[model samples]
Target: MSSEIADAKPTDLPKVSSGSAVVIHPRWVRITHWINVIAMFVMITSGWRIYNASPLFAFTFPPAITIGDALDGLPGALLWHFAAMWLLAVNGATYVALGILTGRFRRKLLPIRPMDVIRDLSAALTGKLSHDDLSVYNAVQRLLYAGVIAAGVVAVASGVSIWKPVQFQEVAAVFGGYDAARFVHFFAMATIVGFLLIHITLAILVPKSLRAMILGR
Candidate 1:
C-alpha cells in the first residue's frame, strides 16, 4: 500500500521560482466545504433510514448508521433527510456559483482530456502520480470532483422524484419510474460514499495533501 502511494514531484509544466507555502483555498471554499461535509453526513444517515423503511434491495442498512432507527422509525429520519436536503442544495448552489464567478472550476477541473486521465491513472497505479503544488489538483482529482458533482445532482434529482412522484413525474420517468428513481437515488448515494472513501484513503496515503484542505497551508 505504501509503495502504491504517489509523491508530489514537479510536473513538466513551465515553472518559476517558488517560495514558502501560501493559502490557495479562499474563505468561500472552506466555508462551503465544511457545510457540505456536515450536510452530507446528515443526509446519508437519514437517507439510510428512509431506505430501510422501504428497501429497494434484499438486505437492509444497519440501524447504527440510520437516523430513523435511532429516533424510532421513518419519521425521525424524514425530518433529518428533509433538513439536510436544503443545506446540501443551498451549499451546492453556492459552491457552483462561486466556482463559476471565481474561475476556480475552470482553472482546476476544466479541459481534462482522455489522454490526461489515462496518464494520471497510469501514474497513480505505478506510484508516479505527482502533487507538487498543494493548491492545484491532479488529473484524477479533477475528474473525481467533476464526477462527484454530477452524482450529487443525480442524488438530488432522484431524491426529489422519489419524494414527489406526481409533481416530478417527468424526472421519475426520465430515470425510468418510481422504482427506478429509488435505484438511482441509491446508486448516487453509493457513488458519493465511494468517492468519500477514496478521498479519505488518498489523504491518509498523502499527508501533505490533507493539510492543504484542513489548515489551508
Candidate 2:
C-alpha cells in the first residue's frame, strides 16, 4: 500500500469525464469567481506594497510580487489598495448575498459536519479521495471555502479598523486596539492567500474543475 501510494501521481487521480460534462458552475458564480481572481491579485500585490511602508514584522514582500510604489507617503499603494478593497468588498457582498438568496450556499456548501471533514481528509491523505463528481463539493472543500469567506469578512473588518482608527474606534476597540487590528488584518490576509494557493493547486490537479469554472460545464 505504501509503495502504491508513493507511485501515485496527480494525473492518476479520478477525473470528471468530458462526455459527462454538465453545468456545474452557473453564470453568476463564474462571473464572481473571475472578478474575485482579479480583485484579489490587485489587493494582495498592492497590500504587499503598503506593508513595506511600515512593516509589521522583520521582513517585507519582494518588489517583484508587490504592486504600486510605496514612496512619498505611500499614496500610490494606498490608492491601489483602497480601489481593490472596494471592488473586493462589493463583489464579495454580492456573491454572498446571491449565494444565500439563491440557496447556492445551502445546496453546495451545507451540512459540513466535523466527522465528514475528518473522513474526507483521511481519504485525501491516503490518496483515496475521488474527484469524479464536479457538481458536488467534498467535505474538505466546503469547510475551506466557508472558512475563507469568514476570513474575508475578518480581513475587511480589520482593514476598516486599521484604515480609520479614529473614525472606527469602536470597531478597532473590538479587536483590542489599533495595533492589534493590524495583526488581525495581517493574519486574515495570510489565511486568504494560503487558501488561494491550495485552491489554485487543486484546480490544476483537477483540470475539470478549472474547465467548469471557465466554460461553466
Candidate 3:
C-alpha cells in the first residue's frame, strides 16, 4: 500500500490542506471598486475647490479650509473634475458589465425583499449588525447601493448641464433649469459624502468589513 501510494502520480494524490484558508477578491470587482473610489475622491476634492470659488452654502461661522482651494485654481479644479468624471464613468460602466455577466447585479444587488430591508434597518439602528452576520449586503444595503448608483448617473447628467449649458440645454431643462441641476449635483455629492461617513463608521464598528472588501472574503 505504501509503495503504491509512493508510485502514484501527483494528480492521483489526494489534495491536502495546511489548515489556512485563502480569501481573495474577484479581480474585476476589486479593480472597478478601487478605481471608482479613487475617482470619487478626486471628484469630491476638485468639486469642492470649484464650489469655493462661489461658496454656495454660507454659515455664520466661516467654512473650514479644503483641499480643493488649497491645491489649485479654478482651471486646475475643472481639469481634475472632468478627468475624474471620465474615470468614474469608465469604472461604473465596467462594474455594471461585470455585474451583468456574473448575474451579481441582479442576484446580489437587485431584487431586494421588503422584509430584509426592514430587518437590516432595524439591525443597523440597534447596532446589532456585524460583518459576519452580514457577509453580503442586506436589503437596505442593496437599496443604498442602488441609490448611490442612481445618484452617480444624476451627478453626471447635472454636471453636463452645467459644463455645456448651451449644448445640453434640454438636459438642463429636465432638472428645472441649470441652477436646479447645479443644486442637484451638489446635493448628490453631499449625499455620497454622508454615505461615505456612515460606511466608514460602520466599517469601524464591524472591523471585518474593510478586510472583506480588501481581501474579498
Record all residue pairs in model 2 with backbone atoms less than 3 Å apart, i.e. clashing: none
Q: Which pairs in model 3 have colliding backbones?
A: none
lDDT of 2: 0.87
Q: lDDT for model 3, please.
A: 0.74
In model 1, which runs have C-alpha deviations exceeding 4 angstroms? Answer: 1-20, 70-72
Better of 1 and 3 by TM-score: 1
The candidate that wins on lDDT is 2
Question: Model 3 over residues 1-217: C-alpha lDDT tens digits?
Answer: 5864565455333333354433333557777988898999898887887887776688221224333334446777788898888898888888877777665565457668889889989997898755564335677789888778778888888888988888989999998898888889998888888888877787797777677577665
Report the alpha-carbon TM-score of model 3 versus the true structure: 0.79
**Model 3, residue 154: what's the lDDT?**
87
Query: CA lDDT of 79 in candidate 1?
Result: 90
| Alpha carbon lDDT of each predicted model | 0.83, 0.87, 0.74
- The predicted structure with the larger lDDT, 1 or 3, is 1
Q: Write the per-residue lDDT of candidate 2 for residues 1-217, one digit (tens) a residue.
A: 5754464454332335567656687788899999999998998888888888899999988877877764543688789999888899999999999888766776678879999999999998898999998878999999999999999899999999999999999999999989999999999999999999999999998898999899888
lDDT of 1 by residue, 198-217 (tens): 98899899897667677665
TM-score of 1: 0.85
Q: TM-scores of the models, in the given order?
A: 0.85, 0.87, 0.79
lDDT of 2 at 135: 76
